[model samples]
Target: MCNEGCLIADLELTFTVKGSHEGSQKILLDSDPSLRIIVFHCVINEQTRLDVTLPEELADGNETVKSGVLSFPLNSLPVQKEIIVEEEAGVVNKYNNRKIIANLSGDLDVRLGFNLCMEEQEFLRKRKKYVAAALKKILHLEEDLKEHEVPVVAITTTGGGTRSLTAMYGSLLGLQKLNLLDCISYIGGLSGTTWTMANLYEDANWSQKYLEDAIKEARKQVTKSKICCFSLDCLKYYYEDLKERTKEGHNTSFIDLWGLVIESMLHDKKDEHRLSDQRQTVDNGQNPLPIYVAINLKSGYSAQAFREWLEFTPYEVGLLKYGASIRAEHFGSEFFMGRLVKRLSETRICYMQGMWSSIFSIDVMYVWNLAADSEDFWCRWTRDRVTDIAEEPFLSMNPYEVDTCLFTPSSVLSSALRDVLTGRPTIAQYPNFIRGFQMHSKYLESEGFSTWKDTVIDSFPNKLMETADDELSLVDTGFFINTSYPPLLRSKREVDVILHLNYSGGSQTLPLDQIAKYISGQGIPFPKIEISEEDRENLKECYVFEDADSPQAPTVLFFPLVNDTFKKYKAPGVERTPEEMAEGKVDVSTILSPFTTREVCFSEENFDKLVKLTDYNVLNNEKLIIRALRLAVARRKQRKY
Candidate 1:
């Protein structure tokens, strides 16, 4: 069958003729096994006539063989000519005017095929126009990006709740162009739920670079005079963790110092229903001890440099007890918070799967498992709260209150800091907090910087290809587990096997029903079967039973059947037969019966059965389908580069 969204054409044909004398004549032709015959009607020129002579006695004691004369329509053409027949060469001719040759030789034969001659011409005309339009838009966008001074104009995406590995691979390629691998550093922690969440902050390096670029761009506008982004929102995660821990009156070992400072500012307005304990305290006069070493921004921290500092932090002591020394270095501050036995007892227990819930991020609020059922929990987790430090200015101002308050350079820093500090550094008004933000945003927009939504949605496909590798091998399977189901298929952590049947080959309907029957025979558990009506109709065209044929594609199989015309018919018998007319016989002509039958299975065993019985002509078809399936599975399992 022709592929969907495609065009097909037939360019040549061969016919065979047989005869003994003036009164005997017959015709035959070669056929292709790959294609199943769908139609046999043809227009014959009026010039040729065929007359048959009957032998005195027939083999079955009947003299009916070739006893009559047959001729094509007369007076339908401008001229008429005598019939010419070639017996040895299997060629047939009409007055030697038209060409004829022996038919194709094969056991699984196809006498006719559908041609898409007109459709092909139309497709070429339209495809050219589509390519031209898409090219113009892409070129225009590329030029706009180049004009802007955007050093790292990357498209970012998230997988599960973590940043997508595809984006990272693309970024690496871009950086490689400039040979900046050494100069640039990637930082971030990955959560197990990277495949389940699409949250950026939970990515191992979400705040590592992209966030750095964004925060720096914002800061440059805030400073007007030009300030390189020296540090990222390293404390952002800590602050989020703190808010959750401080609810209890006592400091939970899990409360990182930075989180505590941010949480303390919310002392006046207590909400018990909130995720964190709603305990209010006075000045708390007790100085919050640093759980981990606070690094000076001046000393840049690289993966190598961090190892040296980890040697000194008191946080390392706790990791030694748990025999997770390497991991302690990974968490650093979080490990510091985990050290206090008192804090662990007071902190609320929460279970989070996927990357987002475990990671700290000021940018992304939170992420939940696709299987997560608690709406209340999900809603509370994602509510965007700027940091708690900005809520109460007076309390945040005291150096002892919190070492630093992370305020947007626009509001809190310019207005509140200016009034609080007796004498601040003399700086240019160019970086007037709020105004700078507007200038930066306007500059980016004027340069045609697209929103994150557009970049990821539009360029995601291209970026994803960057992570693809041909070396990977994938598993091919059917009957995907539906994660939408609750309690059973939804939260299932294991993979289940399935059967896939083909519907593109001959006698398709019969094969499908046969497989379905086999499935029911075995008490194998499966999801409710959903059969498509369009597929049922297409099955009539498949004819594989005669040659034990099947579409090579695992999804399409065919079976063939024999008929008196030497033509083939295949398809499952229908439950209802058509009504007979006064002649007492149903007209087969109007039924448009199947040329073949095809069947589908949702079980692996059924798939094997189809494979074993597949028509030999298209031996490689199933392999092709298997390859495509494997590729898809490989894509799903690939990790970020």
Candidate 2:
């Protein structure tokens, strides 16, 4: 024989394979290095043999080769593999795996209404017990507790930029002081209200004495220089952080820059806080369940559109529209086909804050100048200049008045230039870019995932309803209801009372009215808001609405922040005089506008007045709060009987 034919005479080939349906196998090929191994699918729980054969070159060798058979026992495979198979088959044998079940937790399940997650239901049970004990002590209802059921109460805070944030802090502090905080089961907020919530939850003992200290520190920080967008050092930090996020496969946007700005303002430092980190605050049943709200964005969408509320909690983040939820830790991970495609680190809480507060989309310079002018700083700066060009034409314009001048292509170019120089995008077009699954039309129809109820899914109006796009654009929930409601009203929550804190500048009934209309349209039960013309014209500090026809509808205790009730000297729509402001009356105009930069440096007096005003609003209406709780308890008793 030639030397080439006998070169591999001492070679041995071994094959090893392992799987649950298949098992480990070892094959031996003697005297030939080049050989082919083939294994066919095996029957359930049956032994399968591996076929090892020589290659064409080896078969033609002059040297003799030995072949050996290998057998595998499938039944001896790992139990973990069997568990995975069962999970893939959509049968969850353990309650622990219920959260990650794709079919139930998937965002495509539109037919499913809003429901609490497994974890939330467990938490709520503990919370209700805690509340019942607290209420019994506070209301002196220990004897009546046996005859009545404890009510599920949710308190919702409204959005009004930083002013609303400070006010909400005061309101919560009042509740805490009155021993009512422990009785609340859920705390929901949107926009500026979320700012207060985020800051408070940073400490695990926030409902205790720490809240007052946090509020004081927050006031001091809020009064400092508000223009982080214009600060070179802050902008550098923002750029580096955003660049790192982009490298990690996230699409950087202006919202990221706004998050950086908010981080500087709220924390007075870099924000390293993650959304999942908040679990510690609510862990061990310490605090009320916290819900942060955002909205899904599609092209040409409005508040009246079929809007979806995206709820964020310590345990999970998901959409109420689709009844889908994922662990809060997995919110930013790459998801596909209702499962994680690539595991990514959880999103920073700062980004979520930015999304919650992303109601402004104008140029940073305009916002800055508007703030200065509203506080009369801009006017003073131009007093000594020439009369002709001294005052910037836009300086005198209100937010809505300057929209045409501030939102042009030229402004966008200027903003881009600033972004390039400062390394921060200061204008946000949308809050976040969301990743989702790509499903075929047939699969969607078969699974009842179509946007339409009938077979006319082909003609769905919203492009997002089309299967072509596998991602969603989400923005602030303020664009929709502005007052966080959907999360508290989920069918599983069964909330009997909702304390609606209205801080928006619109009509006092706007938040409650909008939520009632939206919930009614969705067929979600809510108390009918029948506000008389007299109540609308002279809005009170608080109003209550009840649905006589439906016992299931939660009673709404609507509280609108108005100057007439407590701070009568501070007239509505009238700018407070410097003397009155110094005398400790908050200028309602300064605190109520949509403008973001007003009162960048709130005086100690101004800060105290805002807090006092908010606190008084709640304290003055203590009877209303107690009555709402009483009514809720009565309704629960009625249902039980």
Output the number of the TM-score-best candidate. 2
TM-score, every prediction? 0.15, 0.69
206, model 1: CA deviation in Å? 29
Query: Per-residue lDDT tens digits of candidate 1, residues 303-322?
Result: 22221111111112111101
Q: Model 2: runs farther than 4 Å from truth? A: 1-114, 144-148, 300-303, 361-363, 368-465, 568-584, 589-601
In candidate 2, list every pair of residues with a backbone clash.
none
lDDT of 2 by residue, 327-399 (tens): 7877766543344545666778888787787774334345556544463433323222233222457454554
Question: lDDT of all predictions, in order shown?
Answer: 0.22, 0.61
Compute the lDDT for candidate 2.
Answer: 0.61
The model with the greatest lDDT is 2
> What ranges in model 1 sit over 4 Å off?
1-189, 192-244, 247-300, 307-322, 325-343, 346-362, 365-641
